[model samples]
Structures are given as structure tokens and as C-alpha cells.
Target chain A: MKELERVGLPTVHVCTIVPISQTVGANRIVPSVAIPHPLGDPTKPLEEEKAIRRRLLLKALEALQADIEEQTIFGN
Target chain B: MTYRVVHYINQFFAGIGGEERADYPPELREGVVGPGQALQAALGEEAVVVATLVCGDDYFAEHAEEAVDKIIGLLESYRPDALVAGPAFNAGRYGMACGALCDAVSKKLCIPVVTAMYPENPAVEIYRKDLYIVETSDSARGMRDAIPKMARLILKQLNGEPLGRPEEEGYIERGIRVNIFRDRIGAERAVDMLIKKLKGEDFATEYPMPSFDRVPPAPAIQNIREAKIALVTSGGIVPKGNPDRIEASSATKYGEYSIAGLENLTPETHETVHGGYDPTYANDDPDRVLPLDVARELEKEGAFGSLHDKYYATVGNGTPVAYAKKFGEEIAKKLKEADVDGVILTST
Candidate 1:
């Protein structure tokens, strides 16, 4: 978060809900599926869930590569 | 000359009511309520709270256009010298509403729109440049203290006075860069600075180093089969029983914990103690914050040769800039020793 960015760690964050909580210190943010299960809801069948998880994982990777200022949220 | 000031507030602050009163649409009233009263008192005869507008959080968030239109219509008639809103403290919804309104008014009417909030409030980043935001306490208890500071800033804006630093002015640091002139001649100062540098005396840099804008893309892996990747984070993820004990805010240290043979983060094994959010979910399942699960999947897919056995972790909250840079350099040195080709970092 703030400490990491302050120390110049080149960090990015991913969360299922709005990470307003993290923005004070975080350099970047990527929206995820949910709080308890960020990759995908475990209630769904494993195969369907993995597909969603894979997609979000790719989005998180993209967030790390993207240059940003202040705080930015990826994946809308 | 008397300057007219328009005050903006949420339903509760406007005295129109709370959640129940939130449905109340935007309307203009004369004078002030809540912190606006303190603003009026502080600004004194120089400024008058000519109008007050109130709207519900749900109303503004859901029906932004309609609410803004109504509020703007009211403001247009008042023709205020400046607009002031909440030192919203830590209320996210209200802080956002204040930021939105201030941005709109400043852009549309070309009037100075000012508000305040706690540094922790998310609105500081969203609207710090668009408005004059003074830092306040996390609750209304800071009203008496926050209001006077905000009013003083508004007064300075009205008088066309140059603003001092955030610390001096009691505002949240906007991190805006501005060229400032010194009273002393530049040539003399330059010579003095050079002498200090040669003598190894600590001299403040005349020009602060520009922030690095373009990070070189991690060189494309020449061979994914042989390249090693590392997991790093500022998300405050750590092992159970809080072994490393990283400081929560303004962390001076970082920890690199061994994750050998761990395919995934489990609630029982890993936890997050970061103060920024409710760690209930992330603590119960560290992968939600660290994404070790995703890293394992990437390893299985042969995206890289191997995941480094140990991953670096730290608390990113309120960390100072100088220390962060040093930490990154140190971590980079470690990565080099381990032949780490790339890093996939996650944050909360």
C-alpha cells in the first residue's frame, strides 16, 4: 500500500470489491470477483469457476504491467 | 467586497435528515449547518454562506445527473465567490459526493470549490487536485479544529494569496508539483549548494528528482522453461502467528517468507493484519490478498520455469517514499542472487 509505494516497490492490488480501503497506500488496483473468494465463487462447479478465475488472474497480471499514478482500478 | 459562498452538505449535515431523509432532493437554503456553520463563522464578514444545498448519498450516487443539475441550477442563481463542502472525515460516500460536486462546480463555473477529509478517506486521491482539501479527523469531533483551517484556506484563495505547504496550511498533501522561486539569487545558491555537495554536507536538492514514469517492461522471457519468477507484495500478507511482525503503517522493514511446497494460501496457515480493511476474508484465506493460488496455477501451466521458494511481503499502508525505494533496491539485489527473472506482485 502507501508504504510499498513510498518505498518504490512498483506494486499493484487486486480485490473483488471496491478497494477504497486500500487506495490510501496502494499504487494500483484490479477489481476481482468477491471478497471471500477473489478468484471465483466456490459455490459454482469447479470447471466453470476455474474459467472465471483464469480470466481474472490474467487481468491481475495486466494490472502489474500497466503504469499508473495515484490509484487506478483495473477491469472496471 | 463581500464574497458570496455556497455550502454543500449531505442530508445529515444539511439538517434535512439522515438515511430516512436521504431521499430528499437537492434544494437551496440560506445560511449553513454542520461544518458549514463553522466555515461561516471562520470566514466572517469577508464571506457569506449565501446558499446551502442538500442531497442524499443514494440520490447522488444513483441519479447523479438529476441531482447535479438541480444543485447546479441553484448555485447558478447564487453566483458565489467560492463553494465549500465537508471536511467529510472518513465517510466514504459523503467524501465521494463532496469530491464529485467540487470537481463539477470548479470545472463548470470556474469557481474555487474546496472541501476537506481525513487522509484515509478515498476521496483525497480522487479530488485532491480539483479542490482545496484540508485534512481532518476521522469523525465530526474534529469539526471545530478542521473548520477554521478550511476557512483560512478559502480566505487565502479569496485574497489571491499564495498557499503555503500542506503542513503549514493544515490541508492534506495533494502531491502537486509547483515551481517555486526563492528570495536568494539562483547563482549564489547554486554555488553554495555545490560547495556543500563537494564537502559531503547534507544539502537539500534544489530540484527534487522527477518520479520515474516509465518502468522498463520486464524483458520478455527468453525461455520460460529456465526463467525464475518471484512473488512480491505490499499487501501485508504473512505467515500464521505473525512471525515476521511487519509494521502496519509506515513500515520500515520487509519480510521474505519461505513458501516452499505451499501450493496455495489457506486461512489456517496465512493471515493479513493490515489496518486498511477488514482482514476477515484475507486472513481466513491469504490467497484472496496474495494470490499464491494463481501463482501456483501459472507454474503448473509452465508460464515460467519455477516460482521462487520464498516470496517477499510487506505492509504498504502509509509507508514513506524514501524507505520504499531502498526496500525495492534491497529486494532487487536478493532477486538477482536467486536469478529471479520477473516478479508478479499483488496488493490489497
Candidate 2:
């Protein structure tokens, strides 16, 4: 994500560990739900997981489009 | 038998004129001078200051190589057991001179070298790994405390005693990792640390995470609705047969798979090879990690311009930061060539 951002490409990191993402210096970050299934929670039903993934991806898109001078975590 | 020691200091510390005398050439004098008196007293009977080398900060800075060579030549005749440089505090030039002189003496003279400076001194970052630098206060006020630590550390070197950890020894961390046998396995240790953390007790991490360079954010996509987006992942998602053979841990290479005309990642088409986490959920539906299905939904909904046909993937598990950075740069180059306007990078 930092590399992409370096080359003038807007990037958002969807990560389970926000601190790790911050330390790695990602410009934009969206917190994922879990390590095993970052986009979809395993315990949730298939439809629910897809809905959660959609919500998270939407948040990621929001991050990519937002202007930020420093590292910013969207949706905590 | 007393161990012979050599001390190095800047002109100001040698009681020479401050700033105006900063151009004084390197000079060697017998016995302790200035702060060396305190350092010698700290050494007690175990060590004796046999010589002092004083150089102007400007002269050393301007002619570092020559100054170090001259200083080394002057000290070689004394054949001191160890060399000690200044407790330079926050003075940048003096701190650098001390650090450089110590480093040169340790290398060329092949003897133990010790220096002292404030932790925040720029020289600390440059020389901490190569030299033992006792932490000092930001100014000369730290002299009283710094000399003893510097003396003790040098004495440890002279006696060939094993050094303690940086915190225990009052020195800056060298950023070196040493392998040691522990009574408990890593899992048990982690659990113990977690419990301590939960109880709000202080517990040092076995491995401190390395910090990375921060890049200023690029401008936001002005028209994300008309942007060309790409997906990149460190979740180790790949084709059914693992054609690239990327390592499950410490991935050396990244794969760019064609997602062209694909609606979503199915178990028949994709699986995750990442070893850091349980792969069950991702194996069941690779989209759980990559989110191609939702991305397609958004694309069809005209939420963005379009998704790039190729998505990059690599395993983040235990990957060395250097390789990860290289892969990121290469992948970014490809994405740029493909005119990708934005990226959504997922990591496990």
C-alpha cells in the first residue's frame, strides 16, 4: 500500500491489525474483521459474511477516495 | 595490573576556547584531561587513563578521515586496552566526532571502544549498532552520571565479561537480536505476556517491531466513479494448483493472476496458501480474503469505473520486509503501467 501510494496511486490497506498497518506506514487503512477471514467472518452465514465484506469494501473505497495528509484509519 | 585507557574529547571539553577554538588540530596529551578526570576516578583501581586525544569539532568534522587517522596513529604507541570518547550530550558535531572516533578506533586499532551521548543525539542512531554508547542527559549536566556507566562498560570489555542488555547497562539499544534458549515455548510466553498486558503490567516484547518509513499520502482519486481500481493482497490467494509456487511463509515472489471475465473467486479456481492463519475460511471461499465478488458488485453498480483484470497476491507470513518492499514496488510498477487509479490491498 505504501509503495502504491509512493507512485501517486491512491491506496487503502484492508488489514486485521490496525497497529501493524500503521507501523508499516500505510497511508489509508480500513480495519478488517478478523485474521482468518479478513473480508468475511467465518462464523457468519454466507449471505451475512458477503454483506459484511461489502460493507468493509465500501469503507475501503471511501478511504481510497478521501484526501489525507498523513496516515489515516477509516472506520477505526 | 591496571588496564590502560585512552580518552577522546572535543576542544570545548578540553577547556580550550569554545566555538572559536573549534578548529584546533588534533592533539594527544599524557594522562587524563577535562572529563577524563571524572572518568578516571570512576574507573577506580581497575583501569587508568594513560592518554587523552583532543580535536576541534570543526576540524574533525571537516577532516574526519585525516583526523581519525592521525588520532589512531597517536594512540597506537600507547596501546591502550580500551578507548573512551565524549559524553557529548546533545551537541551534534561533538557527538558525531566522538562516535566516529570510537568507531574508527574499534575498527582500525582492534580494541574495545565506548562513547556517551544523549539518546536523542543524531550520532546515537548512526553509531549505536557498532559502538557501546552510554545514554546521557541532553547537556553536560549528565556528565556526572554518564562517566561511571562509560567506565564500567569499557572495563567489562577489558575484562572480557559478557555485556548485559542495553537497558540493564544504561546504553542505547544496539538493535541486534541474539538467540537465547528460553525455558518456556513461544506460545506460553506470548500467553503470559498477553495476561500481563491485560492486567496493565509492563512486559517487554521478545521481538520489537521495526518501524518503517512514512510516505506522505498521495492525492485522493478525484473521480473514483471513473477510476480504474486494482486489487492487491498479501493473503496468499492463488490459482487452484499454486502454479507460482510462492512460499506459504516468507513469500519470495508475488503472483499476478488474470481475473478477467471472472465474476468471483470460487474454491475450484482459487485457494490461500498463507500459513500464518487458519486457511479453512479462505479455502472454503477465496473471496473471503480477496473480496472480488463485492468488488464486482460495486463495479456493476457503477460505484467505480472498472476493476483491473489482473490482481496481485503474495503471502505476508514471516516475509522479510526487504522482499515485501521489493514486491510492492514491482507490483506498483505493473499497476501503474496498467493505469490503475487506486488500489485496495488486503492483508492477513
Candidate 3:
């Protein structure tokens, strides 16, 4: 993500481990669901899981569209 | 029993000449040369400075590969058990030569190699990971102090003795983690640290975070409706069978899959090879890791302009920072050429 940002391409990282993302110098971050399944929750119904993933991606997209001065993790 | 040691020094150190003779070509001499006398005295009778390899700083810097090859060739005949390079002080070129020479000797000749330089020496950043470099003062005035530490370290290495921490051994920290047993359990230690922290007392962390490279945030996407966004992942999501064969851990390569027509990732169409986590969750539904399903949905709903046809994937489990940076640069270059305006990098 740092490389992408260096090359003028705005990037956002979606991951469960926000501290690591911050450490790696990610400029824009959005927390994901969990480690094994970052987007979908197996316990949820297919539709609900899809909703969860869509919400997360929307947050990631928002991060890309929104300017940040420093490493910022979009609150869940 | 006597241990044989080879010493490397720059043109300035050999008393041949200073800046003018910085172009001196590599030369091999019979025994102790200049500073080697001091090193010999420090090594005592246990180790003998078998020979000295001298080279001009400019010559070595300009022709590094050849210089290393030539020096290693000269060193092979000596059959030295260990090698010592100058306490280069703060001389950038000299420190570089010593670091490079020591690095090559240790690798090619399988000998213990040691050098000393000021902590701020530019070469320390480049070669500290590969050499045992004792910290030194900025000038020859510290030679007396530096030589003994260098000798002790090389001797310890030659004897196969366990080395203490960098502070105790008088060497710059190499940032390498060594596992050692502690009397107190981790929870107890954590509590102790917490109490110290709450009391404003000093405490050291067991694991120190390495400094990282920071990049200024790029300007926000101005035209979200027309931006060409790309998806990149360190989640190890790839086509079934992993055609690129990216390692399950410590991946050396990344896979670029054509998601041109793919609306979603199914277990049959995609799977994850990341070894850091249980694959059952990811393999059962790769979209859980890559999120292409929801991404496609957003694209269809006109939430964004378009998704790039090609998506990059690599396993992040235990991958080296150097390789990860390399992969990121390459991937970003291709994305830029493809006119990708933004990216969503998913990590698992």
C-alpha cells in the first residue's frame, strides 16, 4: 500500500489486524471481520454474509475517496 | 592450538598513502600490516594474523564485484579460520569496503568475519544484517577500544561460543531475534511491565518493533464515478490449483489472475494457499478472503467506475519485508500503466 501511495495511486488496506496495517505504513485502513474470514462470517446466512462483505468494501472505498494526513483506521 | 586470521585494511591504513592512493589495487602481504599489529596484540597468542589484504577505497568501490572476487581468491589460500576488517571509524568508503569484503568473505569462504565502524557510518545500514560490526568512535583515536571488541567477537565466533547481547558484546544490534528462556511467565512479565508503565517507571519491551517506511497519503480520488480501481491481496487467493505456485508461506512470487468475467469467487473457482491461518474457512469460500463477490456487486450497482480486469494476489505469511516491498513496487507499476487510479489491498 505504501508503494501504491508512493506512485500516486490512493490505496486502502482492509485487514483484521489494524496495528500491523498501521505498522506497514498504510495510509488508509478499514478493519475486516476476522483472520480466517476477513469479509464473510460463516455463521451468518449467505445474504447476511454478503451484506457484511459489502459493508466492509464500502468502508474501504470510502477510505480511498477520503483524504488522510496520516495512518487512519476507519472505525468499524 | 593457533587460529589463523586474515586482516583487511584500506590504502590509508596500510601507510602506503591517503586520498591520493585511494585507487590502490588489491594486494596480499605475508603478515601483519599497520593496524593488524594492534589486532594481533589484542588476539594474543590464541590467533595469529596470517596475512593482510589491502585495497584502495576507490578501487574497491568502483569495482566491488571484482574486488571481492579477487580478495576472496587471495584469502582462500590463507585458509584462515576468521577474518577482521578495519575499525573503519566514520570513513564512508572505507566502511563500505570493509562491510562488503567481510560480507563476501563470510559467505564465500565460510569464515567468521568481523569489522568495526561508528554507528552512524552509512555502511552500517547496508551491511549490519550480514556482519558482526562492533561500534566504534568516528576516528582512529578509538582503534585501541575497537580492535579488542572485534577480536573478542571473531574469537568467540571461531570457538563456536554463544554470543551475548549486542550491548554486552560491544557490537551494534543486528535486529535479529534470538529465543532464550526466561524465569518468569509471559503473563507475569506483562503485568510487571504494565505496573511499571502505570507507575511511570522504565521498562523494556520483549519485542521491539522495527522502524517502517512512511509514504505521504495520495490525494483522494476526485472522480469516484470514473476512477478505475484495482484489487490487490496478500491473502493468497488464486485460481484453483495455484498455477503460479506461490508458496503457502514466505511466498516469493505473486499471481495475477484475470477476473475479467468473474462475478464471484466460489470454492470450485478459487482457493487460498495462505498457511498462517486454517485454510478451511478461506478454501470453503475464497471470496471471504478476496471479497470479489461483494466487489463485483458494488461494481454492478455503480458504486464505482470499474474494477480492473487483473487482480494481484500473494501470500503474506512470513514473507520478508524486502520481497514484499519489491512485489508492491512491481504490482503498482503495472497498475499505473493499466491506468488504475486507486486500489483496495486486502490482507488476511
The two-chain DockQ for each candidate, comma-separated, is 0.07, 0.79, 0.87
- lDDT (CA) per prediction: 0.74, 0.92, 0.93
lDDT of 3 by residue, B35-127 (tens): 999999999989999999999999999999999999988888888999999989999999999999999888888889999999999999999
Mark the regions of model 2 whose C-alpha exceeds 4 Å error after superposition: A1-10, A22-28, A41-52, A67-76, B15-27, B55-71, B162-165, B175-220, B237-273, B279-286, B292-297, B306-314, B318-341
Off by over 4 Å in 3: B1-6, B15-20, B28-41, B44-52, B72-81, B89-92, B106-111, B118-130, B137-144, B157-162, B173-181
Model 1, global lDDT: 0.74
Clashes of each: 10, 0, 0
Ten-residue region with minimum lDDT total, candidate 1 chain B:
B212-221
- Per-residue accuracy of model 1 over B1-348 as CA lDDT, tens digit each: 989998888888877677887777777888776667778899989989988887887788778877777788889988898988887899888898888898888888888778989987988878886678999999999999888888888889888998998878998767687787889999999999999999999897656643433332232345555656677877788888778788878888889899999988887888876766667767756776676776788888975578889988887678876687678778877777787765656555
lDDT of 3 at B331: 94
lDDT of 2 by residue, B171-242 (tens): 999987778888999999999999999999999998886767888998998898899999999999999989
Cα lDDT, model 3, residue A30: 92
Predicted complex 2: CAPRI docking category: medium
| TM-score of model number 3 | 0.87
What tens-digit string does per-residue lDDT give for candidate 1 at A1-76? 3333443334455654464434234455667776555655556775676677677666655555565544566664
